[model samples]
Target: GRKGDEFAYSHVVARAFDTDHHQLRISSARLHDALQGAVAAMSEPMVSHDAVAFYLLSEEVSRHVKVVQSGQGADEVFAGYHWYPPLAGVDGDDAGATLDAYAGAFFDRAHGGVCDLLAPEWRLDHDASRALVAEHLSRPGAGTAVDRALRLDTQVMLVDDPVKRVDNMTMAWGLEARVPFLDHELVELAAACPPELKLASGGKGVLKEAARRIIPAEVIDRPKGYFPVPALSHLQGAELDLVADALHDPAAKERGLFAAGAVEALLRAPNDALTPLGGNTCWQLGLLELWLQAQGVR
Candidate 1:
């Protein structure tokens, strides 16, 4: 929590379990450590910036704790993400059509925001990546448009983002993490919850009710949030060079994941004024380089 958390830090920290941290700064060393773990964890070069940040935090907590429990599936199972609200408005035939459209956008940022930064000739087979997601969208399930949205997130977001981040980050430090929300019975219970209860106006209606008694109302009712690395601010000077070098590397050139002209434009940007897409791409390129280095590819 940086500044304006709804609940006092101490109470939120207690209830958040191992995922909570009382820090403000994101040092370069933590970023480097996270990239190392990302490379080792991945069989290839796919990156999750969200996981990179969390994995770094998990590394720190692993020093004191040998095992930790998380609320990973709870959000997906209980409909806690902000993305759920958009899907709740439609129903019946149009709802299915909307979900079909939404499925294409589930990873829209990583695809459109970051991947689109690359030149068409240089971009990876993003369609192949999207096809993989489309498979999950087509998974056997029964539920409303919102319920389908929840299932879609469970299939993609929960596993790819949080769970992977925690698992890799904790394991990098020889720690183990468990997710109680993923328990078989608990998952069934969450699945059985009504959409209106799980995904009200904003989202997480039922979870708020459950949290009301167990945790402070302020914490329960507060807007959702998560920690992220300060990559946008970190993208300048020598730090940018590390990323620029990676983009210009002979091996990276061979892979052709980015356009050389686009790389130079990124390097030439003045100060930290790049757009959200630009900042995210810089971080992605840097992490990919770090991962490649760990793989002995660059």
Candidate 2:
């Protein structure tokens, strides 16, 4: 956690505004104990480390305030992801090329790679992930490759992923979280702006420029910060055993969601096998079984 700039920038912004600011730090032991509760609150199998941090943070925030404003949709609405910049100037008329570009950047693994990890019965007859993205990209309202990418992310992925994560975690703690960036009027205006504008200054240039008027320049110019749980990155000691136990459990064996060879390979070198997006393969597989078991599903 000491390696992260999140705390530093947060302190700078907090002091600049001169609002009543408090800090909450969590230890590995506390995070481990809170893991199941975080997973349970999500009520779905998402492997992002952000969920646990939000869940734990909401627990603290609820004690201070009943409602909080979260900067969740700003990235999607303003095109703040790495993929957005690359999609600029691509031929939107070429459906195949557009889909290839978007999927190449967004999907963690190709459908073929995904099928390799599943047992035969669990494998799908088609590339469902590709099909979904293709349909979203082909929609009429978006004019360019970047627009299509932003549309898909803001309308589809953002709603189901990060937005849901914030909602579930805050609601679990009896706190209400409001997202102003997602307001229909603001989103419509942002959507109408040229894709190149949103893609400038690395990404979300418009938002960053507007922020400069209010916040310090150092924060506006700093590299983006991500929430990382170092303990989970390369599993060791009790953390490794926690994942090993879940995959080895009789329930996991009965479910047969994953092929034995793939599971065994990941277990043998848990830290080495990573997805295209660099997610830990061992944790991804273990998380599914862990979630199913938590939900009491057969």
Candidate 3:
């Protein structure tokens, strides 16, 4: 729990289990200080926003524990994302439709939008992201559109993004994390379960039902909560300054990854310019520049 930003429902479960619970609260200043360290820890750049929270949380957790179990692969293995439902009744053989649906729901921005953001020289001639998705979808074993989407997410996106974020952040503090849902046997079982079963109860239905037996209904039935980090989400004060600095730096201008006009527009309205996925676009762009500079890539 992170003080004012805590999910009240989590506290309910803690009380029910009578588990030793500890909470960590972070200030905007402390979070800003940890940002560079979080970026440095990652093997590659990620714009997942919650990475800093994981970094700070892991630092605190290491004081008490060496290794901890995390629920990392549950969503991918169990089909818990909002994108799963529309693909539910889609024809198994319609690979194009499946790729379109998945791209519509998950890609941060469309290819045209990405082209607009990048310098002309940096823009790709084709939808490389879609090509990547299509390659994964064509792979053997997955039976239906939803199955392909699940397989793609579980095998590709989850490994690179959330799992990597957790690994990098946790290991930064000498803390080891075990993702039980990713155990080979469990993943295989989850992969084999009918998509309909996993998509029920508003997604992850099977897991929710199983959880009902042990945990309180409130925790199981409530809306999925992403770890909150408000300071980064709606940047202001020193946090906003940090992002502005990175995007405007000499190295960023020399590299010219983003179009000058696009970068300027984001700086003008940092809070308003968001990606289709609701990410702060300024932060995403700035973080890339920051990470590159940190790595001495320039």
Candidate 4:
């Protein structure tokens, strides 16, 4: 109606089944497969599989539908990847040390690059610099550096990160979803596994090797590309201005999700021009405004 066109299309959507950071690159093929599967399932009378297929299909059809499914938890359950493998012939302790050293060296190089790019006023001394580097390297769990890294990702990424995009989009379309990955039982099982077994040198060492017999190696071994939405690109121009306006507007201040003066400062600050807050931040602000509006709080 907006475009004054008459057309009907079917969409088949799938959740992020893999844990790869770059979901776009990882899930492209899988998404295609899902859409094909949905279309095929639709042609036949609704079987049990079709029921699942159609639910996912409806999500695809909606302008902004977020389906909360638990593909990540399933991976962890069946030992699907994300387990850090020990380097060949290295003792557990040594393997941990090797990873830590590698991380530290990488951090130092990255810090140097960032420092070179930053203004002179932002520069810090060696101790401060190393501390900042350590903050980036540190993770949530106790144990080796690699273990901690895995824990951090599991805690922050797999558990909580999905909500940022998924919940927002789903709610935007007036849908509610429950993710099974947040299941306590599944997370406990995955967390109980020894790191050596999980991160074996050959990629999700144990899980991948085990799954090869059940699922084709091609399917299991396919490179993972997670949600690859060009979020930043989507949030530019009018969208960015809308966000900026909401943040700085007196009416937004009266609504009071944020401190009016602080929001104004953020808007007026020069940093937004040079290093604009990315789409995630903009989306979050928009969602907050939407929620406030719904509650009649603003």
User: For each candidate, what TM-score against the reference?
Assistant: 0.78, 0.96, 0.96, 0.43
For candidate 3, write residues 1-298 as lDDT tens digits.
Answer: 2233554876997899998877777887799899989999988988888899999999999999999999998989898988889898777688888888888888888899889899999999999988999888877778888899998998789999999999999999999999999999999888889999999998998988888889899888887778777776787888889999998889989999997699889888888977887788888888889899889898
Model 3: runs farther than 4 Å from truth?
1-4
> Could you tell me the lDDT of residue 45 within candidate 4?
22
Per-residue lDDT over 193-274 for candidate 4, one digit per residue giving the tens place of the 0 to 100 score: 6666765534465567766665545455555433223322244554446557555556655655543244444445423422
RMSD in angstroms, all models? 4.3, 1.5, 1.8, 12.9
| Model 4 bad stretches (over 4 Å) | 1-69, 74-142, 149-159, 163-186, 201-203, 231-234, 253-298
Task: Give the true-structure RMSD of model 2.
Answer: 1.5
lDDT of 3 at 84: 89
> What residue runs in model 2 are displaced by over 4 Å at the alpha carbon?
1-5
**C-alpha lDDT (0 to 100) for residue 43 of candidate 2:** 58
Query: What Cα-based lDDT does every candidate model obtain?
Result: 0.64, 0.84, 0.87, 0.42
Better of 3 and 4 by lDDT: 3
Flag regions of model 1 displaced more than 4 Å.
Answer: 1-8, 11-46, 50-52, 92-96, 100-105, 109-140, 232-234, 270-279
